[model samples]
Target: MKAVGVIVEYNPFHNGHKYHLDETKRKTNPDCTIAVMSGNFLQRGEPALVSKWARTKMALEAGIDLVIELPYAFATQKAENFANGAISLLSALHCEEVCFGSENGTIDDFTSTVSFMKKNQQAYDHTTRQYLKEGYSYPKSASLAYSSLANHDTYVDLSKPNNILGYHYVKAIHDQKSSLKAETIMRTSAGYHDERFSHESIASATSIRKALFSAERDIKEIQNYLPQSTTKWLSAYFEEYKLFHRWEEYFTLLKYKLLTSSPSELANIYEAEEGIENRLLAFISESTSFQDFMEKIKTKRYTWTRLQRLCVHILTNTTKDQLKKINENPVATYIRLLGMSQKGQRFLNHVKKDVEIPILSKATGFSDDLFTLDQKAAQTYLAIFPEPLRTQLLRQEYAKPPIRFNEEQQIYL
Candidate 1:
C-alpha cells in the first residue's frame, strides 16, 4: 500500500491542519497518510496546549490514517534535527512521499535553496562560525550565512519558520538519499506568528492557541477556527481540565530548578552553553516569573525560544552528557503508535513484518535511553495538569490501547 507521511504538532487540531491533511491526500492520492507528531512537548520548546493523546485523537479524527510519536529528543530540537528525525521515521516506515506546508515558496524553490546550501556547504559553515564568533545565536548566524553564501535575495527567506523547516525537510531527504518524494502545499491563510484571527477557519495554530488561553476572548469563539470534531474535543477537555496549559504554568517549577541548581550544574544541562548558566544563575533570585526570568536571560546570542528549551532541559534534568549520548545514536529506535483508524490498523499490519523499527502499541517492555526520555517528557506533561486528569492521562498511555475508529464508532477518545 502506498503511504504518504507528514510531520506535525497539531497542538490542537485547527481547521488549517484539516485542510492540509485533505490537501495532502487529494494531491498524493496515497492509500494511507501517516503523521509523525511531537508528543507533550513541541519543537518550540514549550508544552503543547493539550496532551499528546488529545492531539493524536484530533489527527485520527481529522483524516490521518496513523499517528506516531516523534521522540522527545527530536521533538524538542532545532529545525534541522527535528526535520531529520521526522524524515528518518518516514523513511524507516517505508513511506513513498512526504508533504509539508510551505509559506514562502513552491517545492522547486525550496529544493533549489537546499541545492544551493549543499553546493556552498563549506562557505556556509565558515560564515556561520564567523557570525557565531561575533556572538549571534546559531539560528541568526545560519540565516546570515545562508544569505551571504547564496548571494541571493531568496536565501534570506530561510529565516522564516516554514521555509527553514521546509528547507531542512528536503535537505534531509537529499542528504540521506531517501526514496521519499517531497511535496509542498502553499500556506493558504493565517501566518505562523499571527496572534489574532483573520479568517476564522484558516487561522494559524498560534492564533487559535492565543485565543484559547486569553481571558478576554470568549472560548466559544474558538469553535469558529477549529473543525467540529476539534471543537467538541476541546470543549470536552476544557470542561474536564478547567484550563489548557501553557509553558508559563511550569515557570514555578523551572524557577525552583534553577535556584536549587548550582552554576556548575546548570552549565551541564543541555543547551546551556558558554557561561549561559552563570547568567541564568544570576537572575534566579531576582526574576519572579517565567517571562521575567526569560527576558533577564535573553541576549543577542540566545533567543526566547532557545532559553525556554534550556529551561525545559533543566526541568527535565536532561544533561549535556545525556544528550551527547543520544545524539551519537540519532536514528529512531522505535515507532510509537499514538492512534489509528481502521485503515490505519490494516496499514500497520501490512507494514509490521517489514518495518525496521519496533512498532510499540503501548509503553511496555521498552527501555531504550531515548524512550525513557520520552516517558520523562510525558511525566513532565502530567505534572503540569490537575490531579485526576494527570493520573488519567498517565494510565491512558500504559493501559488504554491506540484509539481506533470506524464507520460505526464515528469517534472514540
Candidate 2:
C-alpha cells in the first residue's frame, strides 16, 4: 500500500493542520498517511500545551492513519537533525512520499536547493566556517554560504522557517538516496507567527495557543480556528484540568540546574558550544527569568532558540556524550505507536514483519537507551503538573494503550 509521511508537532491540532492533512491526502492519494509527531516537549524547547496522547488522538481523529512518537532527542534538535530523524523514520516505514506545508515553496524549489547543496558541499562548508569564524550564528552562516555558492537568491527564500525545514527534509532524503517523493502544500493563510485568527478556516497554531493562554481566556477565538474533533476534546480537557504549558513554568528548575552545576558540567551538555558554558554561568546569577537568561547569553553566534534548547538539554541532563552514543547506534531502534485508526491497524499488520525497527505500542519491557530517554522526558513533563494528577499522568504513559478509533471499535472518547 502507498503511504505518505508527515513530521508534525500539532501542539494543539488547529484548522490549518486539518487543511494540510486534507491537501496531502488529495495530492498523494495514499492508502495511508503516517505522522512522526513530537512528544511532550517540542522543537521550540518548550513543553507542549497538552500531552502527546491527546495530540495523537487529535491526529487520528482528523484523518491520520497512524501516529508515531518522534523521540525527544531528535524532536528537540535543530532543523537539519530533526529532518534527518523524521525522514529516517519515514524511510524505515517504507513510505513512498513525504508531504510538508511550506509558506512559499514548491517541490522543485526544495529539490533544486538540495541538489545545489550536495554539488557545492565543499565550498558551502568553507564559506559557512568562514562566517562562523567571523561570529555569525550557524543558521545565518549556513544560509549565507548556500546563497553564495548557489550564486542566486536561495538565501532569502530559505530563510523562512517552514521552507528551511522543507529544504532539510528533501536534503535528508537525497543524502539517504531514499525513494521517497517530497511534496509541499503552499500555505494559504495566516503566517507562522501571526497571533490572531484569520479569515475562513485557517489560523496558525501560534495564534491559537496565544489566544487560549491570554489573560482574557478567549475560548470563542480558539474555537473558531479548531476542527470539530480538536474543539470537542480540547474544550472538555480544559474544563477538567489545566491545558497550557510554557517554558516559563520550568524556568525555576532550569535555573537551579545551571546555578548548581559546575562550568565543566554545563559545558558537556548537548549544544553547549565552546564558550557558552562561561556565558551561562555569568548570566545565571543575574538573570531573574528564562527570558532574561536567554537575553543575557544571546549573541550573533547563538540565537535565543539555540540557547533555549541548550538550556533544555541541561535541564534534561542530556549530555553531549550521551547524544553521541545514541547517534552512533542505528537511527531509531524502535518506532513507538501513539494512536491510529482501523485502517492504520491493518497497515501496521501488513508491514509489521517487514518493518526495520521494533514497533512498540507500550513502553514496558523496553531496554533501549533512546526509549529510556523518552520515558525520562515524560517524567520531566509530569513534574510540572500537580501532585495526584502528576502521578496519574505518569502512569498513563506506560499503561495507556495506543488510542484506536473506528466506526465499529468501542473505545474511550
Candidate 3:
C-alpha cells in the first residue's frame, strides 16, 4: 500500500488544517494517509487546547486514515529535531511521500535552500554565531544568516514560521538521506501566528485560540473555522475540563518547579542555557502570571517561543542528561497508534509484516525511556485537572487502545 505522511499538531483542527490535509491528499493521492501528531504538549511548548485523543478523533474523521503520536522526545523539540523525528518515523514506516504546508509552497525552493546551506555551511554557521553573539534571537539570527548567504536572492524566506519549519522538513529528508519524496502546498488564507481572525472561514489556530480564550469567550466565533468533529470534541473537552489547556493553568505548578529548584539544578534542565537559570530565579518571584513572568524574563537572546519550550522542559522535569541519552538514537523507537479508521487498519495489517519498527496499539509494557517520557507527558498534562477527571484521563494512558473508527458502522468501536 502506498502511504503518504503528514507531520501535524492539530491543536484543535481548524479549517486551515483541513485545507492543508485536503490539498496534501489531492497532491499525493496515496492509498493510505498517515499523520504523526504531537501529543498532549506541542512544538511551541504550549499544551494542546484538548487532549491527544480528542485531536486524533478530529484527524481520523477529517480524512487521515491513520493517526500516530509523535513521541514527546520529538514533539517538544526545536524545528530541526522535530522534523528529524517526524521525517524519520515516516521513513521508518516506509512512507512513499511526506507533505507539509508552507508559506513558500514550492518544493524546489526548499530543496534549493538545503543545498545552498550545505554548500555555504561553514560561512552560514559563522554568520549565525556572529548574530547570536550580538544577541539576536535564534530565529532572527538564522534568517539574517540566510539572507547574508543569499546576498541578492533568498529563495525560501527562512523568516516566516511555516517556511522555517518547511525548510527543516526538507533538510531532514535530505540529511537522513531517506527515500520518501517531499512536497509542499502554499498556505491559503491565514498566517501561522495571526492573533485575530481576518478571514471568514479560515483563521490561524492562534487566532481561533485567542477567540476561545478571549474576555468575550465566544466559542461560536471560531466554530466556522473548525470541522464538526473538532468543534464537538473541543467543546466536550472544555465542558468537562472547565478550562482549556494554557500556560497560565499550569503557572502555579511551574512556579513551584521554578522556585524549589536551585540555580545549579536549573542549569541541568534542557534549554536552560547561558545563566538563564539565575535570570529565572531573579524574576520568577516578582511575576504575577505566566505572561508577566515571561515578559520579565524575556531577552534579545531568548524568544518567547524558545522560553516557553524551556518551560515545558522544566515543567516535565526533563533534564539535559536524560534527553541526551534518548536522542542518542535520534529517531523514535516505535510507532504508537493513537487512532485508526477501517482503511488505516487494513493498511497497517498489509504493511505490518514488513515494517521495520514495532507498532504499538496499547501503551502498557513499553519500558523504553522514549515511551516512558511519552506517558509522563500525558500524565503531566492531566495534572492540570482536578482529581476524578484527572485520574479518569490518566488511566487511558495505560489501558486505552488505539481508537477505532468504523466507517461502515459510522461510529468509533
TM-score of each: 0.95, 0.93, 0.97
> Where does the lowest 10-residue lDDT sum fall in candidate 1?
147-156
What are the per-residue Cα lDDT tens digits for candidate 3 across 138-200?
888988998887843547888888888898988988878899999999998889999977888
Cα lDDT for residue 369, candidate 2: 77
In candidate 2, stretches whose alpha carbon ends up further than 4 angstroms from where it belongs are 151-156, 196-200, 328-330, 407-413
What lDDT does model 1 reach?
0.84
What candidate 1 gets wrong by more than 4 Å, as runs, is: 151-156, 386-392, 407-409
CA lDDT of every candidate? 0.84, 0.83, 0.89
Residue 120 lDDT in candidate 2: 79
Per-residue error for 37 in candidate 1, Å, reads 0.7
Q: TM-score ranking from best to worst?
A: 3, 1, 2
The candidate that achieves the highest lDDT relative to the unseen native structure:
3
- For all candidates, the clash counts are 0, 0, 0
Q: Please give the distance, in angstroms, between residue 124's alpha carbon in candidate 1 and its true position after superposition.
A: 0.6
- Return the number of clashes found in candidate 1: 0
Q: Which candidate number has the best TM-score? A: 3
